[model samples]
Target: MPTSSPQPPPPADGLLSAARRNLREVAHGLTHASHPPTPLFADAPRPWQRLLPYGVVLALAATLIPVTINFLISEYGVPGGVAGALGVAQAAPLLMLAHRPLQAWWIVFPADIIGALVLLGYPVATYTVWPWTPPAIVGYLFLLLALGLRETRRTSIAVWLATGAAGVVLHVISPGRSNGSALLLPVLGAVVLVIAAAVRERGDAQRRLAEQETISEAERAQRTLLEERTRIARELHDVVAHHMSVITVQADSAPYRISGLSEEAVEEFGSIAASARESLAEMRRLLVVLRSDGTEGERAPQPGLDRLQQLVEATVRAGLPAELSLAADLGDVPQTVDLSAYRIVQEALANVVRHAPGARTRVSIASDGEHLTVVVANDRAERLGSPLEPTGTGHGLVGMRERVRLTGGTLDTGPLPDGGFRVAARLPLSPASPSSLEDL
Candidate 1:
């Protein structure tokens, strides 16, 4: 049998350790967790809103003091000085609560005890020690709410319990003219505490909710920006892929088209074509990631001048009658130029579809051997359907300008005098090297 290790001896200062643990628990229980304080009248409340609370409370305090003093002087026959002083003590603390709530709380109980004794001792004891008189009730209600707003629940509970104990002592020692109000005061105090707690909790919840909404809005803006960047990247990838495809085609057919003499020349051409094809393949994989829908199959090729007819036909089918005209020999144009030329028309036509619905559109492409020009013009809509809404935010023209710029091109777009819109782009037909295409 394996021998068990001896148990550690109890702490030498076991009693002291237990006492420390008990003190920690007591402190934790007494000190309630709290957040940054939110005053009922905030630090920077509007002038009117801030003044309203102070004005209302001061008015109540003013009214309560005079009425209580008059009652004491007329009915209880207390000295004028004593009545006035007691009334001031009871009501003055309420005024202090306007600025310093917790400090005001400390003053209320002492004022009440003094007022009750002055009334009971001199006059024939009309009411109990802590009677729920109108003035007393109003004062307690205000103090309870102010304390709940500015302090923690533990502090409020401690005050509430202490008030109840004081009332109990008053009832036992000198039960006076009426005990009914004595019972009512604590019940009403409990209700006021509940309402104050509810209000404070609601304020905390609203603050938390507002914070969450702000975070969500920021996240949404960031997501929109990322999506726009991805779209731009995908378009540039199309530009790169188009050039790479052309390089592959030209390299493969070089030896066959140019009557090459050396076998080494043929092998070199074959290597160039193979490398171009591999680069194109890698770019296509990246495109898949950019435009992923979880399908692992070949995507259709990027559109060029050859697909102009198909695009026009599709536009017609979508209810925007469009006409296409190729005025120059676009067949010999470089692939990047061909692609930019196509996208310019495509975006312009899309804009026509969106902004000038039911308008006749003309797409024209021309090349002067050095530059390729594309023009897409539309007339004002004769029959306006609801204009097509873009899937992305309003960056359509910005995207067009960017595409033209990347291809060493210029774009001009504006409204025409005929109440229509025109978009034109001229792309340089510079023949980029295969290595440059690979880098793109």
Candidate 2:
């Protein structure tokens, strides 16, 4: 017996297999047509406008239902009851456009093909071809406009070009040309794109405006704080000037009041009085500038590293036991930088005196020609015999930060590991003045 070759599949089986494959392709397309992040149809300010799209989609589907039924019953000679059912089936996918737009497009392509093959008529007596029937135009135009709003510009443009190419191909192959309005589709798409662009630009402008308002508020607060600091400096100048004036007078008159005073003692008294008077004059000049409405003048000489020893001794006398260390030589630091450094040390020591009473404090200064680093640390407060807890304004750190910011410096302050507190700052050095090195 000869071996038999495998029999070819029958026509019915082959057709069924092809139909299943087409169904799978449609399902895959519909499932993969993603919903966009920013959807085109969304809630509108007017309640009716939000519902208008749904109403239009339903109306389009309804019109197509009657057209499908007439083609099935009158043209194809199907039973009236079955034709009604088939019409409902045909309208179902088009109605789905309101929810699954891309999926509905996928469904429409095959539905139109099947309708032409089965019904054997042209859009139920509409003059247009089965593919570009009135309902089909509505569906395609709506989908294109919606995609322009929902998807990104690149994706929308690609889809629009593809749709145009498909239309051109269909028009060339069809027996009759489509209606003349077919040429206006691109213009309609451009209009939709313009609307979407305007909406996006308006949203961006609003966001930028909100950010600018926040920045303006922050700058206003900073300006107010600096003004307050200047005012305090002006008021304190009077107290300092009075004490210096008293010291100058007392030192100048001391030699005459004492009998049998040595010549060296008299000379020392005169020198002490002169120095006090000079300091008093400088203080008065700086205060006048600070209080004046005038904009331009030379500022009084600011204290620098030369005054560090005096500041430390004064802090000690005020009952903050502070030790000072200079890790590197001060080499011609700028006057502003020098003044900022002195103020930082002064404020840190003051905080320790008020907040960390009886705490052993250490002050360290290091400079490497380009930058200066200052560190002040104090141990936790331990109640001593006589308590002198001065009330603080609580703006010491704020003032320190302002000073550091003015000098283009960075500051870090926090508690130490051993129940102590530390403040560290690094300031950029500026060009040294003529007397900067001499003062240091």
Candidate 3:
């Protein structure tokens, strides 16, 4: 689970920061590299790109250091060949940092040491530069990046100061070079790099924070949607159930308003009307269960084997040609098994009506001292050329399957060989260790 936590971003100059923000976007795209965005870096960066920043800085330092050495050749009055070789040696470490940043840790220290040694050598060289513009800031800057990038600040700072002292030594050794102001250049470079590092870390933090905000917004939206759906379900269930119950009671009382009726005959007719009203109420409540609000948890009736006959009556009224059969001699089936059997039959028949209208339907419910079975078979659909379209989303079948499975049962649904569709489900008889507590 990749968690989204708030993060502060890195900070640098406008251009560097702008570049880095763009880079962070690229980095985020890279983060899901297991599923990369673009074709190339979606995996990982090419070797060179990973090394470019370190490479460029080191290359620039190496280039500058030699120029400084060439400018100072005369002041030291050392042999030209010896000075030239010393300059190349001084620049080489900086160049190496480009290809191998890890090596820069070792290289940065030595470069600082050499520059320090050269500063110390100034007394021996007997040299002087009146205006102190020591370009040796290059060594300090390299150390800054080393420490900043790698979090090796203490060692970097110590090396920087040491080499800085050596650079001062070089001037003091030269004749008439009594002044040592060139030492400050390395100190300034160290400060700049420290500031730069802080800026970088700050920007990274900010980008992470922005991502957190995005995720939080999405979650709030999801919560709101769920709440709204629950409210709607509650309202629909309450309103429909209340109204249908009222209508059912009213219909049952309707025969009393009939005037010229024989007392016994009227009583019989009223009795029949009341039965019809009760069945109608049950049908209306079933529709409410299926299509109205999903909230009001206990408002929906729990239909099970007790309600099987009602389900059959409802189907007969729906214009389906149906024959329902049940076998006796049933053992004690579990409550969950009994409930699941009824639901499977109910959904199977509903699907037949929706997908195979005007078809002959057969329903069977049986318990044979072992498993309880419920089977619904219907003729092929005239409209679809089959009871189910090949491209069905399968949710109805899936729901039926789930209900059966949850109750320790198995269900199968498919086209029957004889130009029809059949759904059969078998649920377990009473649990071996029957539950004493009512609710599971």
- The whole-model lDDT of each prediction reads 0.74, 0.68, 0.59
lDDT of 1 at 310: 89
Model 2 regions lying over 4 Å from their true place? 1-126, 129-151, 175-177, 231-440
List TM-score per model, in order: 0.63, 0.39, 0.37
C-alpha lDDT of candidate 1 relative to the true structure: 0.74
Runs in model 1 with CA error above 4 Å? 1-51, 96-99, 126-133, 172-182, 249-275, 294-440
Model 1 pairs whose backbones collide: none
Model 2's lDDT to the true fold? 0.68
What is residue 256's positional error in candidate 2, in angstroms?
A: 6.4
lDDT string, candidate 3, 309-343, tens digits: 87778777766677888776566766556656776
Over the stretch 1-440, how does candidate 2's per-residue lDDT look in tens digits? 99999998788788889988866764554446545432234545686776777787788787877886776666556578866765665565666555566656556645544443444433434443443444444555666555544444555565566556655655565536454334455566566657756776676597689889999989877766766467446544654665688999989999878889899999999999999999988987887778758754334644678889998988888877889998657787765667678878887887887777889999999988888999999998877454565433325787677666656778999999999999999987874345433321
Residue 295 CA error for candidate 1 (Å)? 5.5
Per-model tally of clashing residue pairs: 0, 0, 33
